[model samples]
Target: MSTTPMFPSNLLPNEASPEWMNKGDNAWQLTAATLVGLQSVPGLVILYGSIVKKKWAVNSAFMALYAFAAVLICWVGWGYRMSFGESLVFFWGRPAVALDQKFLLEKAFVGMYPTATMVFFQFVFAAITLILIAGALLGRMNIYAWMLFVPLWLTFSYTIGAFSVWCPTGWLAKAGVIDYSGGYVIHLSSGVAGFTAAYWVGPRASADRENFPPNNIILMLAGAGLLWMGWTGFNGGDPYVVSIDASLAVLNTHVCAATSLLVWLFLDIIFFGKPSVIGAVQGMITGLVCITPAAGVVQGWAAILMGVMSGSIPWFSMMVLHKKIALLKQVDDTMAVFHTHAVAGSLGGILTGIFAEPKLNRLFYQVDDWEKYIGLAYGLNSGRTSAGFHQMGVQLGGILFIIVLNIVTTSLICLFIRLIMPLRLSDKELEVGDDVVHGEEAYSLWGDGEIFDNTKHYTEHNTAFDLEDGSSSMKKTATEVQLT
Candidate 1:
């Protein structure tokens, strides 16, 4: 058997091509990274802050923020190596640091582009996947436990999925599977892991259930916009180098998102009296996530159809199906990660089988060994184009492989962490918010003195409570919560 080299001696394009230095794509990559960064830091950060009740706002934001920071450090230090370094195991990458500028400037892999661009591009995917998982375990999980879990899960789970699907030597890659973006690695894996982690962590406080309205709608909208714009980089950058197809990928991603949003609005108007901003945001995210795996592979029409399934099916799962299914409601997935990521990702993977055009695949892989490409080829594009089942079957195998892996691994890790220390915070801390745990509050409107027990309450109610008992001593006491 001939062994394949880890790093390709030369990229698919010659080493001196000006397209490699297009600077436009480079700018796009940086812009995309910044946009994606915004999604986690302020985007998901504020969205979670607003969606959860005030009591848990800080906690929710902290969960997302901490995961973002923690993943970056781990990614550059070690996680990146494990995912893209080399094909060691059939299912995972070999471990090695990607530190020098030399590696970045060179071609990424045999079939890809500049290594540096690839590294930064893949880092965003890794970071976001972890952040996505944070959605499920937000309110109740201990910050300390979460800190430990992030790195552990990255090492044990995230890398394996990345290597298997994207790395050249990965079994799935060799088997001719396609993931234009991260339906399998980012969405599907994280969705399953998120749900499993939530199952292990349990639910929020009883009091939180009685009143859990969003604290700030405007902030949530800002977050939503960031998530929407970030797709430019998320899917666009997947091609590894700046190219025409990368542009097509970005266009396709947005088109799918727009179509899904319209369909969702239609569904909401038909069923509910009003279309909720929350519903719109959910539709937007599901559309984006659903198109991820199939972004560059299928036709634009296929993307629209995938969006419909993504928006409707996940909406149903979150709205009706989860309520009807007793087992699903048992695990409180704080933000419907399973529906948006896992279900949508899986559906995208399956649709890729039905809708994928082999011509697109050839264009993506930049077929050099025509014999090899032809050997693995399924069929042609459009109705006139011949189709085959082999490619579709391979795609299905990837979905199943990732699902089983995530479920088993995430559960084991969470259970193991629980054995060492309880995953949830105490009853008292749940009410205290992020100020107590991380020593940081997301928003502070106060211009002067600290808002504390000693200071008189501001806004509505004009009364103070007695410190000794849990009773309101003053009859005219203001009930506005002190904002610090």
Candidate 2:
């Protein structure tokens, strides 16, 4: 009886759906966030699991899975606000809880959607960044150490980059440095942090380092396919609206990726005399990272040019320069994240400054500050050369900031974690890999119902029986045992 008379017949628009909220934008933002999340969970989880050597598969995949879950808890608890909330310093924001209903239901600072949508959307980006860092540490990093590294790196390293570049009040944003999606924030930071962590964690075991190969190439490609397709949300969702710029970003993303993949495939054929699926995947990733900062702002032709540069430049860095550089050779970057993400991300930032179209920039940034947002090409054509140079300088400055920040913060984080636990796994664990580290194997060679025994299956000296003969008396050394 009380319920029947107390409430209004219909709720007002302001009560449930705020006047400022665009239903289409909110729906698209949610969908885009889910796509990005998919790239990390099953996408990266499968990729990491199948891409590593058979013995190391489980551990590698678990690292990504753990980071995804850990980053979400930290993001909503405090990471989100520290990234996009009120400024605490020029490069950081005040940390605060993002889970409150009052806060989540409010109009977001930038988008025509609720704060909850922004929080979830941004959380996926944060989670993926940590998962990317796990790539370099795959084969040998201690899982316990990674558990600590995830939350700490997100707080000290990721938030600063995000605050400096993406937040409306961010210093770089005010200075007109453009990072359309996260070439700088996610890719560059992850690349630098990963390489730094790898240096501190040390390389995988000598044997694993020398001969590690994918356990399942077909499944690795499937995960890569998910990563490639999921980028529609990665670049497309950055605009925070379902607008023409969003469509341009989605198209540009694919075009750049496809072009870069072809260029990388052809280069592999010319140089290595064979097509490599791994090389092609690296090319696709580089293309995605390279276009991220300029996807919506650059024209279609510029996207192709960017793809060509990304395909060739990062390929050279990884295949040639990594071999020549003393420091690069010393660092054990397991997945070559430094080349795929750091180099490509930097190239994208610089390219964005050179190729960003004034009209498209205006559409994305919604700013009329012609001097600040003008790309180098447009500035030269429009007789505003100084503006273009300024933009280029800003781009370089952002890159420097990110590189320095990650190098210092990541190194410090690793050192700090080292105090509590070993950054790299013990020698015994590294040699045994997934079986020893996680008490599991990626594939069981025995019958389906058999329980795996470390002593019998993975001992330093396994006894091999010559079952081909009539007698089981003949035995061979572990090295001679070939299950296949």
Candidate 3:
């Protein structure tokens, strides 16, 4: 083989090396976006598939995969502009296609990177938001209705939240609300929209709601692991440039998540008498959500403090309050996203108001005004107490805006989808599940030298029994569960 250079010797001076770009920042932004994308594709896809009952494995996983593809198409077409383009109003942006080559090659408004990179990164965030909303509607939502819901919700709901919170001209951004990544635009919005959609789509089938069990606990953990690790990008990339703030955000993100997981794990062991893996995962997620808004603005001690609360508050809401509150029980959020994401996100936003350091906020916001963004803790210590109260009020306003916006937009989207199609799966489809709905099953088994009958399939009554003892072997002959 010849040892030759990859690029041509006569390559132009400025063709690849742009006059106004930082290659490292662009590269990191792309990598960060891809990591966040992984959190949705294989990450969420695997988690949803293995976490649901065996019958719903295909449907649950497909919803995530489909949303990822659908949102990308819509995002480039018009959704992106509607989210971050010229302000149509205080709470919205004007819609336009984001697919022009001339436009994509230019420097982005907010970063030193090309507009194309910004679009791609923002699209991943938008896609994941839609995927999280799907978490609430899983198991009973009609596939066709979901297809409509994704694009419509992207237009009506997600765009509004993204525009109002993250966009430079957004009303909330102008009001000094700080959502470093997507605590408001993504998490709190998804949680509320999901719960509202669940109300309109109704619950999973009684059988599924009563007794759904994870088909593969180990596989579920693997997917959750991907999500946990993927946050390096989720919070790290929000700064749009690699700097000390990005590094600090990444460290704080992991520290908070780890602390919250341990706190929640210990809480479960003390209260329930055993450390439940599922509960620990929930805690891990809440910790991640709780710190997202303040990851860069908080110190190590603040992250730890946020973690402790994240691990407990969501647990109380999920375990005790969910039982006492009739409204929560009535909605039937299949994945409990309302508790894990909505509650945790709101908690994080409030805590961000409390613990955000003045120095870090200035670094992240690139602002010199000390009065505008001081956290309550620092404000009191520094004698700018009113500014801190103002920041906290803005935080609450952002939360209230998100909750109301999602409820209205999601309800309308559901009602509109209902006009053309039934929002819920048919009774027969609900009863039969993936086989009848998708003509496939998540798992199958064959003997050492033989294939099974075409009419039969393995199930919880079959493969689950084999795996219950933690055996590696998957012997085919167990009690049969008839498809009919």
lDDT (Cα) of model 1: 0.76
Clashing pairs in 1: 104-116, 461-478, 462-478, 463-477, 463-478
> Sorted on TM-score, highest at the top, how do the candidates line up?
2, 3, 1
lDDT of each: 0.76, 0.91, 0.89
Our model 1 lands, by Cα RMSD against the true structure, at: 6.8
Residue 301 Cα positional deviation in candidate 1, in Å, after optimal superposition: 1.7
* Clashes per model (N, Cα, C within 3 A): 5, 0, 0
- Mind sharing the TM-score for model 1? 0.85
TM-score of each: 0.85, 0.92, 0.91
lDDT of 1 at 329: 81
Q: Which of the two candidates, 1 or 3, achieves a greater lDDT against the reference?
A: 3
Model 1 residue 133 distance off true place after TM-score fit, in angstroms: 0.5
Candidate 1, residue 84: CA error in Å? 1.1
Question: Which candidate's TM-score is highest?
Answer: 2
Whichever of 1 and 3 has more TM-score, that candidate is 3
Top candidate, metric lDDT: 2
* Candidate number with the higher TM-score (2 or 3): 2
